[model samples]
Structures are given as structure tokens and as C-alpha cells.
Target: MQEKALSPTVSTEIITLTINGTSKQLEVEVWTSLLDLLREPLDLTGTKKGCDHGQCGACTILLDGKRINSCLTLAVMHDGSELTTIEGLAQDGELHPVQQAFIDHDAFQCGYCTPGQICSTIGLINEGKAKTLDDIRDLMSGNICRCGAYTNIVKVVQEALERNHKA
Candidate 1:
């Protein structure tokens, strides 16, 4: 097989986005995913790099108040959008309800997936699509926790849902 020479492509664009309540402006390659945007220059590593293919939901983040797999979309695509990562979910040195609920319920192990879990939980709650344990499981099916802590995770979700509903 003859090796074909590939054309080199280099294009970088400047984008501004609200990340974790901070406005960030950065120049990046067009192919950079939102996950890389957070992890690279922005240095927000709370969003995990699991699977890196949008399957595990480890890179889940809130884009414009909705949850999305950050690994699936390009950074330039979300210019001027609001993004909330695991780090952004907290307020005034206090954990977000979902984070607190997860801690109170011991909903994590190994901790690789906790960040994603937390972000996903917040997103799920904001979505208001889960009204029951089953609904939570079905809706949160994308975030894979190898620790098999689904029971505790579900409990946290249930608590957060009830609490958020009251508010």
C-alpha cells in the first residue's frame, strides 16, 4: 500500500465561554472538544476523561443549563455559551445539593467517575425528567460507575430530587 501524503490543516479560533461562573477567552484549534477546552488551558480537571468517546458520560457538563457530553462537541461550537462543570456546581465554599447528597450517601468509590457523576446528577435534576428511582437509573444510564455504587448514587439522586423539588 502506497502511503499517501496528507494535507496539513491548522486553524485556531478564539472563543469566549462562561466556565464554572468565570468568563474565559482562549484561542484553540477547531477540533478541540469541550472536554479538552476545560482540561487544557482552562485547567478544570474535575470533568473526567473516561472513555473519551462520549459513551461513559465522564465528560458530562452543562452547556446552556443542559447536560451534554463535553467529549462529543468541539470547543468552538459553544462560543458564548454557559458551561458548568463539577467545579462550578458549588457555591461559597459549600457543596451543591447534589454534591452534598452524594457525600452524605457515600455515593462514590475510586473517585474517577465522581466528578462526572456529580455534574450529571445536577444536569439530571435540572432536566426534571427523573421522578422516581427507576427514572433516575434510566436517565443516568450513561454515567458508568465501575464501583457498582448505583444504589447509593440513586439514593443521592432521590434525595436531591426531593430537596430541589421543594425549592
Candidate 2:
């Protein structure tokens, strides 16, 4: 006789993480990815899942203060860690300097890549690796804006970088 399934089996893991300064405990499958966990149960959709292969920076998010491809990591792997998506950049009803700079500079066209651009810009600043315009451009090369807004995007990033330095 063919072996029958013993029982309807399901495994879930409870992960505790701080998202946008809010602590969340979610029961997720071991295979659930960080991007899916954020966009699905957490309802944080700002982090887009473009080219899910990590070629595009559309799925970028801050993991423990560093930019990482959320799609490449499992949610269960980040238990007890801090995460910052595009939604987390704002504070007290005010836009983050990077976000405001984007708006002021009109750095987006279709806007599908704006969130990633903004998030990456913030992370770029935190990394402290880009000291010149060319450096910034090189560091932000991973993020692709199909709308061809690179010039404006670079301006916005530069403005935000200077603004952050003044603060």
C-alpha cells in the first residue's frame, strides 16, 4: 500500500523583530522571505519586490542599520534584529531629509523606484563611504531608475547628504 500522509503538517516559526521602531512578533514559515514577510503580514508595501533576484535595488531595506536585499534573506534569520523599510524613514509626521530632498528635486518619474532610491540614499549616508559625487554615483550604482532620473536622483542624494552633514 502506498504510504498515506500521517497528518496535515504545517510548521511555523515565531520571529520577533523591530520594524520601523515597532516591535513585531509574527508566526511565519521557515521559508518565508524578509520581503514577503514585510509586504504580506506586516502590510509594509513600500519595499517593492522587483527583479526578486537582487539585481535591482527595489527590494532594499535596512537590516540592523545596513542596506540589504530583503528578498535574499529569510525572515526567520532576522529574529531580534532591527529593520527599516521606506515606511520607517519618516518621523513625527515629518518626511526624512532624504525623502524631502527627493520631492524637492523631483528625482522620480514613474515613482516605482523612488522608495528604494530614498532608502538606499539614507543607507549610503550611514555607510560614510561616498565622499564625492562620483563616489556617491558609484555607491548607488546598484539602484536602477528606469525612468532615467539619474541626474535628479543624484542631486537629491547630494542635497540630503549635505543636509545631514549640517545637522
Candidate 3:
């Protein structure tokens, strides 16, 4: 008797998204989160997976130049939207000013949350909402640092703002 072979399941819908200045078209499950799409499907691992929920803000990314929690959003929801991950901020192998400032200030402990922090900072900076430490804190309230490096994170944002203003 001949044995029957099982066929693999295939998805029909294709999602087109622009990530880190590049366009990607992929077939994915409808329930796939942006975090999984970025890290696993696209191989952009800089966006860390922390809480896997929106609470931690570890998977923050810029969607149409605005910061959003990728873990809470479906990949298909961002179709046709431009995304900027941690990988997108650098140019010519040089770190973005915000990224460098974080390093200079030692803004991270375990470094697991740095990507979200930096991305959220970039969004806050672009929004012109972090003019004061209090303002920065309020704006960045979404991103949590489990290592308790809030002071250093705030310092990095302030330094980056000053540097960016001067340049």
C-alpha cells in the first residue's frame, strides 16, 4: 500500500512594506505581528523582543515617521507604510546622533531595550516634544527600562537634542 503525503500550508496574501528605506513583499499569516515580521521574516533583529506585548515598548519602530509598538501591531496593518527600525537610523556605517549619545551616556544596562528607547527618542525629537526633562519623561513613558537606567536615558536624549540643535 502507498502512503499519502502531507502538503504544506500556504498563505495567499502578500504584504508590501517599506522598512529601513527598503521595500519588502512577503507572504505571511494574518496574525503575524510587526515585531515577528521584522525580526524573523525580514531578518532585522535589532528590534528586540522583550515583553511581546505593547507594554514594554521593546519593539518600537517608526511607522510613517511616528513611533509605534510593533509587538502590538499586525504586520498587514502597516502595509504600504514606511518603517524605520534600529537598523534604519545609521548611515555609512556611522551611528545616528541619538544612537551615539545613548552609547556615550551608557543609557542602557542590558541593552535589550535600547532599540525601543532610541527609536522612541527619535520620534519624540522629531515631534519637538522633549524640550524639558519632564517633557521627555512624559513622552518616553511608554518605553520601560527594566535595568532602571532612566536617568542615563534622559541624559542621552538631552545631549542628543543639544547636539542636534547645534548642528
Candidate 4:
């Protein structure tokens, strides 16, 4: 009689990502979600994990300047991609325009969804697809704020769009 191994060796891959304007090379398990990699080893806890299934949009992040649910993607899948988390939105002690807008408009409650909402709004602005109020609502519907801050959130986004156009 002999003991047998129940599983094979774990697979891992090294990835380079430009996060928050910094380049990092990290070795992560193949199956590790981007959300896990961010919150765990990178210690970036601002990206929430409300619903790991990607339905809640709590883990939304800017991957290559586009918004994507970090929980829905694998860390290995985004090699060579540039990512921006909430932590990176502020620079040199000054918050990004959208971040400042959120604060000015008080667009958050409980603050759980603020990070995702802000990131999504930035992506939306970058896409240049949201033109009107309804367009903003439709484009931002993916990110939910259980605190019911939709009104102020919309205002913040609208202001951000205007600011971008004026820039």
C-alpha cells in the first residue's frame, strides 16, 4: 500500500502591470482573479469584493483605460495591461477631477461603491459615449450603489463630462 498525491502542482505565471502609474512584476496563480491579486498581495483594498460573481460591479477597475469587473477576470489574462484602482486616482495630494467631483457633490453613501462608481465614471468619460443624462444613466447602470445615491452620482458624472469637454 502506498500513499498517492491527490493533485498536481499549482500553475503560476508572472505578469507585468502598470498599476497606479507604477510598473510591477508579480507571480500569480493561474486561477487567481484580478480582484484577489489586487486585494491580497498588492494590498489594494479599495476595490471592493461585494459580489465575486461580477454582478454587483463592486470590483470594477480601469484595465487599459476601460472599466471591467476585476473579479470576473483572471490576473494572468491581463498581462502587460495598465490598471488604475481607486488608490491611484489621487495624485500629489490632489484628487483626480472625478474624485473631486464626487466629494463636491457628496455622491456616495456608506462609501462602499464609491471607488467602482468613480472608476466607471472615468472610463465612461474616456469613452466619450455618454452625451445626455439618459445616456449617463444607461452607461452607468452597470455600477450599482445600494445606498441609493443615484441622483448625486449622476450629477457628479454630468459635471465631470462638462469639465472634460471644457478642458
Candidate 5:
């Protein structure tokens, strides 16, 4: 006689996050990536999942006012965190300054990486380390634009930085 085998159970936990200014309490599997958590259950698709290995920077998002590659992190690791995707950057029907600057400067092509670029740029400016054009370049190197829009992207960052300094 043969015995029946038991199936493995999936681990799940409840987490609370303030996403795009809205508080969300979600139950997710423990092994789910932050990128999947945003794109799947939450339906916030603006944060793209490119490469899914943290190399392409397409899954970048602001976590606690700092930018991080969402694909590199697990959702369970960030409970009670404030998170922002591209969807969170606008307010009262007005685009964020960085979003407007990107439009004014024509900083994107194909736009797959635009969300991450914008989020990362905002994070860079907040850090206050980009004093020169070269510094912006170095600081933003993590974001890769396959369409080769670096020149205009840098222009947008420079202008946004200038505006931030003036404000």
C-alpha cells in the first residue's frame, strides 16, 4: 500500500503600504517581488518590469523618498513604507516638475524607461549630490535608456535641479 503525499503550502502575510498617497493593506505571498506586487495585485503598471534583475532599471520606484529598483526587493521586506510609482508623481491634474521638464525637454523615446528615469531623477535631486552636469550623469548611470535618450534626459535633470535649487 502507498501513502498519499501532502502538498506544500504557500506562505502569505499582510502588509500595509502607502502607495501613491493611498494606504493599501494587501495580502501577498512572501516570495513575491516588489515589482510584481505593484504590477499585479495593485494594478499600478506604470512601474515597468524590464530585465527583472535590477540591471535595466525599468522597475525603479521611490521607497521612503529614495529610489530603488523594485525588482531587487521582496514585497514582504517593506511593510509600513511609503512608496511612489510613476502614477504618484502628479497632483491636482498637474504634472510634477520633473514630468513637465521631461516633456519640455523631449527627454524620452519609446518611454519604457521613462518612469524609472523620472523617479530616479527625483530621488537624485532630493539627495542633493548632483552639483554639476557630470555629477548628474554619474548619479543617473544606474538607469539605462535603450532608446539612447541620455542627452535630453540629462538636460531635463539639469533643468529640474536648477528649478529645485531656486525653490
Candidate 6:
């Protein structure tokens, strides 16, 4: 009996992105989500994987300085866009203000959602969306912390914003 040849599977498509400060090109599957492509292909694991669905903000990343749920977006859709992850927020081994605020305020419990929280906060600050406590709450509603440290998270974000404003 002769074995039949199996059809080849295309696992990647050409993708180009400006991540952090550098440009990157990689062959990724058309259906691959930005989260997977970022974590697996690019080795930028700072973006955590929670509920692959958009319900959770665990896979949040900055697209052109705006926070977006990476799991809900396709890698190819952002071909020429600028991308920023938790990894990009730090510079010269220094944590971004938001990241430092989270640490200072003990904003996270399990630390599983820290990256998303930080990313979302970055967006909220950059967009000037986190003005009042209610505004912060509304803006961060999408990112859920399983440990329920929301109060501290809010404080951290607000504090970070204040510090950023002062700087």
C-alpha cells in the first residue's frame, strides 16, 4: 500500500509592524490573533494570555499608542500599525510610571492581570480618558482582575496619572 501525500498547511503570513521602537517582519498565519503572534512569534510574553476571548483584557496591548485587546484582533489587521506591549513601557531597565504605581500601590494580587492593567492604564492616560474616578472605572471596566483588587488598581492608575502630570 502506498501512503498518500498530505497537503501542506500554511502556518504564517508576512506581517510587518513597528513595535516599541523597532520594525519587525514575520510570517504568521492569517487567522493568528495579535496576542498569539506577539507572544509566540515575537517572544514578547509580557502580554499575558487570559481568556482568549475579548471578555478579558489580559491580552491588552497598545496599537499606535491606544490600548486594544490583542486577543480580539488579528495580527494581519495591524500590519503597518505601531504596537506596544508591557515590554515596551520600560526604558533602560526603568519601569514606566504606571508600572511603578501598580507596584507601589500593590494593585495586583496574583499578578496575572498586571500587564493588561498597566497597558490599559497607559492608554487611559495617553488618551486623557482617566480624569475622574468614575472615568477611570468606566475606562477600565473591560479589564477584570480575578483577585478583585480593583480599588487598589484604581488608586494606582490615578496616582500614576497624577505623577505623570507633575512630570
Q: Over the stretch 102-163, how does candidate 4's per-residue lDDT look in tens digits?
A: 98999998999999999999999989999999999999988999999999999999999998
- The local distance difference test score of model 2 is 0.89
lDDT of each: 0.89, 0.89, 0.89, 0.94, 0.94, 0.89
Q: Give a tens-digit lDDT track for model 2, residues 83-155.
A: 9999988899999878888888899998888888888998999997888999989999989999899999999
lDDT of 1 by residue, 1-167 (tens): 76556956679999899887889788989999999989988889988899999889889888998889999999999889999999887899988878888889999989888888888888898888898778999999989999999999999989888988898
Q: Estimate each model's TM-score.
A: 0.93, 0.93, 0.90, 0.95, 0.96, 0.91
Task: State the local distance difference test value for candidate 6.
Answer: 0.89
lDDT of 3 by residue, 74-158 (tens): 8877668899999999999999988888988889999999999999999988887678889888999999999999999999888
lDDT score for residue 1 of model 1: 75
In the order shown, the candidates' Cα RMSDs to the true structure are: 4.1, 2.6, 2.9, 2.1, 2.4, 2.5
Candidate 6 per-residue lDDT, tens place, 42-97, comes to 89998999999988899999999888999998898888899999988889999887
Stretches of candidate 1 off by over 4 Å are 1-7
In model 2, what lDDT does residue 81 have? 98
Q: Name the 10 consecutive residues with the lowest summed lDDT in model 2.
A: 2-11
* Candidate 2 residue pairs in backbone clash: none
> Which 10-residue window in model 4 sums to the lowest lDDT?
1-10
What 10-residue stretch in candidate 5 is worst by lDDT? 1-10
Candidate 1 accuracy as lDDT = 0.89
* Winner of 1 and 6 under TM-score: 1
Clash pairs for candidate 3: none
